[model samples]
Target: MFTTRPGRPPSWRRALVTGGAGFLGSHLCTRLLDAGTEVDCLDDLTTGRPGNVEHLAARPGFRFLHLDITDPCAPDAVTGPYDLVLHLAGPGAPADCRRRPLKSLDAAGLGTRTALGLADRDGARFLLVSSAEACDGRGDDGPPRSPWDDGHGDTADAPDPIGPLHTYAEAARFAEALVTAHAGARASNAGIVRLYPSYGPRMRTDDGRTLSTLIHHALAGAPLTVPGDGSRPLSVCYADDTAEGILLVAASRSVRPVDIGADPEPTVAEVARAVLGLTGSHAPLEFTDAPERRSGGPFDGRPDGRGPDTGFARELYGWVPKVSWREGLARTVTAVSGCPGPAPATTAGHGTGRWLP
Candidate 1:
């Protein structure tokens, strides 16, 4: 657990979450509603599952809007004097990126622009939920490569000047730049949150993230396919902790981007073993989402070689992850399996850095 910075946490009367139906977005929506804030959850369901927000639809002060943030009409569709606008309207999963490549680019570009505009108009605080690609904060992997050369190694394309397509990392980079530019030009109360990896309920089984894939394989009694000798440091945070960190950043008036995540240190193989133990499945390990398998294709559940940085999050908001990966993973398993979680497990791998593994 972490300490709350000395001060009153920021509160909102109402909020607008662009990707409110998505995994993390849905969590944010639920948190805001629980705080007695009116929430207008909007999503076109491009990469988001409607069922994620279905439970919240009946809750008081919750409104689900089926609208694409990239659509020109999106502006008119959202009538509001919102105090907060969380711009999380983008394809979050690797599988979604592979299936909807252009949509990823559009969300980062047009989607971010639309959300920022709405926030500025309503005089609301805005937060652009971003991926780790916003910066080379993690030095383990080199920068993105040319789209054509991605098959060689370190998958991802450079931001093309005139190309219609872009990789998810490129899209995230562009989105952060846009948010920064928006704040500079209009002096809007906006910030960007660079998320590393998070796992919990509502995660799509086919999302291709390391933990999601491992859990899926364990539950199905299938092989736990891994990548790169399964030694990558894949740290992660629980959805509940991630949601609260995001809200903390949103409440603050800082515009600088902050990294939010927490967890015990663990290698890919260790993560897989934990999943298998929890499910009580003897699923064999299979190293498949490896470098050789990247082929410049969509992201395959690989953790970016870098660890989480909680410096800004701690200094600014006094935020740190509350749940260990084991605890969070157990909750996720119970949610997915519709049964009581297995008995309490031993402590997760020792040591902590960024919140996920």
Candidate 2:
């Protein structure tokens, strides 16, 4: 639903996506290749699996580099005069962050620095796939407020940093600051994309996020579980839409953070029922005590506030989400149901199972 800016040639021809083996990252690689850009996908495989990108192995323009972005000489391995770099290499799932807090912090802090350095070195446009968690914390009550609402306008509106800096929320907030500082110093042409809930094909079954968990349960004919009162509202965007928004930001010259996702958010219970109907599973909906309930928590299963205000994206790039929740859920069910094994390690002709070191 968005068109490229007129009279300006698309700036990126050679691109690098830092988390290219993950669910959303893989979709991005596909989009970039479809646009004829040469893509170098960098993933450490800490949380990202190689099978997610196996389909892309055969594309002449696509290459996968297995390297941790936090290493001192990580950037040295990639040969680039790249036109764009998308930094998406951090742990986003709440469970993963909870299990490895330091790794999350380092990935956001050091990983972002590495990605920005690459962009600065190549004069490439840079984009950070930030989380909605970066927004100020909120309670599960009251009408949901948009990211651009009175109290949620910019990163400056984020909670005071004087307090303890742990947890994924704080880590992402710190990462955003790093990016803003880099841009302020005029080090790189950069933008930030704050993603809401995103789901689609190739989502890891054990990722422990709400949508994926429900789908996993439904497919197994197990009970779909909801935490708390199940009144929490969620605004989920399909993977393709999320990927498109990221690409739009990369192509734009804007430096402000843009919220990319859907609206008319659904409640957790609503989504659970929808999944059941789509999967034709007779599973009963069950409620259970949640391990922890924090706004934007992976298991929290709802937006902390109102859905994102995507007007900025629309005005800037003529972009908006095109997938309805019904259609999106149906597609996800089909994809997941058809997969007969662990994500295939290699597509027929894309490449060999062995990854590049």
Measured by lDDT, the strongest candidate is 2
Q: Would you estimate the TM-scores of all the predictions?
A: 0.82, 0.83
Please count the clashing residue pairs in each candidate, in the order shown. 10, 4
* CA lDDT of each prediction against the hidden true structure: 0.73, 0.75
> How would you encode candidate 1's per-residue C-alpha lDDT over 52-154 as one tens digit per residue?
8778867888887777788887788788879899999878765566677788889889999999999989899899888763343533353322223454556
Note each model's CA RMSD in angstroms: 9.8, 5.6
lDDT of 2 by residue, 94-157 (tens): 6667666887899889999999999989888899888875542332453333332455454333
Could you tell me how far off, in angstroms, the CA of residue 7 lies in candidate 2 after the best superposition?
Answer: 13
Off by over 4 Å in 1: 1-9, 133-166, 292-304, 338-357
Model 2 lDDT on a 0 to 1 scale: 0.75
Q: For residue 215, give model 2's deviation from the true position in Å.
A: 1.0
